[model samples]
Target: MKALKIAKSPDDAIKELLSSLFENQKIKGVFSLFYDQDYFYGLVTDKELFNKLTPTAPVMPANGGKMLSRLTMIEPPAVPIAVVLKPCELRAFYELSKLEQANLENLIFISFVCAGVLSLKEIKNNIEEKVANANQKQGLRECCQLCENFVPENADLILPLIDGDNKTTIFIKTERGEELLQGIENNLVEEDFDSAKLSSIKEERSRYREKTWQNLKTENLGIPGLIDIFGRCINCHACGRACPICYCNLCYFDSADNDSGPRVYEAELERRGALRAPSGTIFYHIGRMIHVSLSCVGCGMCSDVCPVSIPVGTIFTRVAEETQRLFNYVPGRNLEEKIPISTFEIKEFEELGEA
Candidate 1:
């Protein structure tokens, strides 16, 4: 597929393109994000809302994948729709589809050459300045800073964000994309591709990720470190709510059994020195790890919505890497690769847990 280069600011281009999509009846709907004066919001198709879309507006405190699931999980749209999302969001949504929590039948995936997320300050004040300035580089969120997968791999359409490369052409990656974008050839250009720029960027990102992993492993990982970071949790379960993959309609942690009565509290105080008021702090955290570590995509929604500001996403991601490595699986890399839980081979692992 031929890739498109985005030379000028993308907001103008998006405005024109999306307006056309709405008018052409090519798509029944559109799903993406928009930024106002102080906040960013996930929005569905609205021709009334132009030049306000910001698909790459950094600082995503929540996962857009969760939003997509709400739109398409139970019932896919009757007609095709275009949805713009980040790479990580796409990955998480893919996992949800595997669990039968979402369907992708009538949706078009649109993504850009991602450079990772930005800080909230950058999103609010520096967005236009940073986009306009060729010399400036936006600082990434912690999850984004350590991320190895920065580009959207299998989207139907992709736009380039690499600096100084904007002859801005959109690459069609699927027959569906071709159908939707058919004959609207006014703004797009296609040509011979060079993989050097993207490769170099990936290499640098990989190196940084390796270094960050080493540092995270050496200094701030393991059980004790996790407790230290998460000790402030008030048992709010905000992290679970924010996570797209933690899709249990009735989570065990928040059930009636977890509510502590006077007798339950007295038993707890008898066993331990002091009972943490809203009990099961460690239980909740451990349960989360065991339940979703293999599927965790580390979108930073957990950290973003945490009331106490724990780095929940990074902590889960670090542990998840270990667990996923043990199983030799990546959460959303391929739809065909069966999850470790479902794929059993009795012939394998003669002494699986032996020391």
Candidate 2:
């Protein structure tokens, strides 16, 4: 692994580095974030256009991985493409790749050591303020605060954002990244990465995350706690719409069969004295959990989109962590790690065998 440095601002240096991918005859397309009306991910061939990218924006309105998954699913690049994604976004995209929802061939992923992301509402749709806030390592959403994977894995390149805004370290992790470095070596200064500083931050974040997990026990959040957490749910399904792991073309909850005839409501009314007008809130949520618990990357999109102000992302992350623990797996950490429910093995986990 080699590190490179530049004497330009984070945005400017990143623009120069990413733009060089286009000039290199090997790369054909670029995928990155841009703020037009709102933040958007686009596939642009023009390297110069990357100058406008805000890849490290503090708040994410939606998961960019879902968009990249759709794009790669529909059509792979005829030539190699360089794509820049946040660590969480890259992790979600990696999860989708395992499910075959996304193809990874001809794609070079660029990721960075993430600080954390905040609530979009807290930033109030202010783009300038959002960019400025990216430097702060605290005041993040619940899910982000608990996230331990600050540095991305399996990325071709990892950009380390330092304490200051102007200077940063670009670490080349893969052969694909080395190729890009060779192209821009003249412009880059060789620098040793500040491992001590990075380690200190990781230790601090991990300690904070451990404390949060302890506080969120079921004894502290039982039946009434669940109701209080999701009581205001309008059953709008907006959370599912925003989730990157929910790659289903049509959700089971959205099926016509789920909206049964009058007799179904009558049966429900008979069973429960009276039902909530928009019933099945808990059912819908659990069903989603059954589907995505093993693959959830904890990107916090569900909580971000919830109109009722529910801590959907935090709840899902807690459940996902437990579910993943049962199988001794971490989603997106390993490309070869099979999703538990998708495969069958006879000898595995016999201790838990009901027989």
Candidate 3:
């Protein structure tokens, strides 16, 4: 739990640190987490050549965590991988670890303080113009704006942009992270941060969250209001795809043989009443609530990816806070703590009375 500052020159510090990671082969591959065009992409690092290349491709948020899960199944084993992820991604990975779908032993998690990311269209219209005008449009991504996970959890290294400089304030949160930084400590200068300043920063973040939640609650006042909050959703599942925690090999929606079958169409034709074509926005959200509410880390990426701009993360966090409080669980705070759902007690639900 040591806090340190990179050298005065931020980019130089980043390059030096990355080069060292490459030199030791501590990083088998580097995954650059950035926003490009209008979506989030993970660019794999070329360790052999020490070059960072966006391989003939890019993966959206849908493929991000799921791809990591599939990597665990590779035979002969793959090299230890380095991934730059948000808090939600880490939380998703944590959840997957619990499900036995993924292993975190050979991975290095690097996380950056995210402000918020913008949509693809919004990026093209807004950020692209700014970056193009500045002649720096080469490797940028569009989803960096609306990203709200400024501080990630369970990361080996945490990078935050502070002051006018991109000087990444690197904090070692784990023993592995401390060991990695130990090798590069000589290259960096240590600086004691002002306790008051850190407190102020936290307070500011809290204020932002307070306002965000207030606005969302005000916008969705009641049941009808809540329905209206997601009324514009076309059930595209874009929100699910964008969510780093919504990891399922095969989703229920992927099924072609729905139980309703012909009755669904018959009922629709019988009355002028319209059946919500892509039903289950409410159900999808509720299911997620029940599934991950105890582990929600408030990354805010879910709301960022919603097409209609529903504040899904806010609602999830608001509910998750209550859920975690009830169970006395805080995801990612300590890896040793057992997940609430994973353990049970005979007397836990005794209040329900004997059957």
Candidate 4:
């Protein structure tokens, strides 16, 4: 539970600290960040080796909080994988684990206190300047700008970039994390905890969330409201794919058995014929609300991945807050609690009528 600081470059700090977890031929695998495929960043884990990081890596896009949900489905689960993730990713992973979509039995969550990250496009535009002006701050991606969950909620090992200090604040939040850190605890320097600063940061984030939801609600007005809100949707389903709780093996839209493509086209034609696209643009949002509202962690990946720049995460978070409040449930807070729909009492609706 003690906060410890270590002086080292970010990359070197990560490599040195994580190297211990792979010691004594005990580690089976690792899931960490690496550059692969067309993506500049991705999650890679070893399915084959135990002693070293795997050379044959399966990398996907570092699309904020989507990787952990997919990690649940990895065949022949990789145990003791050192997953390098952001705070939102950790929160999403915890929520998914609570919903049974993710199994974190042997996963080591190594999270960063993110200031935010730059998109590839932004990186390209200011490549020369970005290289020169290492201190510049405004060139970050839109998703990173809106992100409020900078401090991790469920990370086993937290790496914080405290107050412009390039070194990391290595803190353990779980028994598993403590066990892992025991090996390198001697190298850590004890520091006075900043309770006030931490609280201020959290308060600022909460205010940002409130302001965002208020604006989103004000913007979404009426019947043409839904259309105007999602008018540019090309039906790509990127939001669904980015969602950590949307864990269907073969989704209806993705399945060959469903005539969803044709159905969507026909619905569009009907819209051209003066019929509204009844829940057409918002079907995924509606379907997800019904499916995983209880488990939604509000990581904002849905909005982050939307090509049309819709505020999908803000809408979901607003709805999820109300839904969770109604059910008296907080997702990812505890693993043992039953999901709302899964729990029912015979006397619960006794006042409604004679059953």
**Per-model TM-score on C-alpha atoms:** 0.86, 0.92, 0.75, 0.76
Summed backbone clashes in each candidate are 4, 0, 16, 0
Lowest lDDT sum, 10 consecutive residues, model 3, at: 50-59
Q: How many Å off is the CA of 320 in candidate 1?
A: 1.5
RMSD to native, candidate 3: 5.4
Q: Which stretches of candidate 1 lie over 4 Å from their true place?
A: 3-8, 38-43, 120-139, 163-166, 186-193, 218-223, 260-264, 353-355
Best TM-score among the predictions, by candidate number: 2
Residue 341 Cα positional deviation in candidate 2, in Å, after optimal superposition? 0.9
Per-residue lDDT, model 1, residue 254, is 85
**Candidate 3 global CA lDDT score:** 0.59
The 0-to-1 C-alpha lDDT of every candidate, in the order given, reads 0.74, 0.79, 0.59, 0.61
Residues 1-355, candidate 3, lDDT per residue (tens digit)?
A: 4766665443344445666777787665665444444334454565443333221122234435545655653431366666666555566667666666777777877765544333343344465454334321233232222223446767887665454454556676678877776765754444443345345556655666677667666434665776777777777776666555566656665456433577876787688566676765676677777876787766555765677877777787878877898878877666677789889777777767777
Q: Write the per-residue lDDT of candidate 2 for residues 26-97, one digit (tens) a residue.
A: 577778777666777888887656666877766676787888899888667778888888888998998898
Clashing pairs in 2: none
Models sorted by lDDT, best on top:
2, 1, 4, 3
List ranges where model 3 is wrong by over 4 Å. Answer: 1-5, 8-12, 34-40, 43-67, 73-77, 126-149, 163-169, 181-195, 218-222, 256-259, 264-274, 353-355
Task: Select the stronger candidate by lDDT from 2 and 3.
Answer: 2
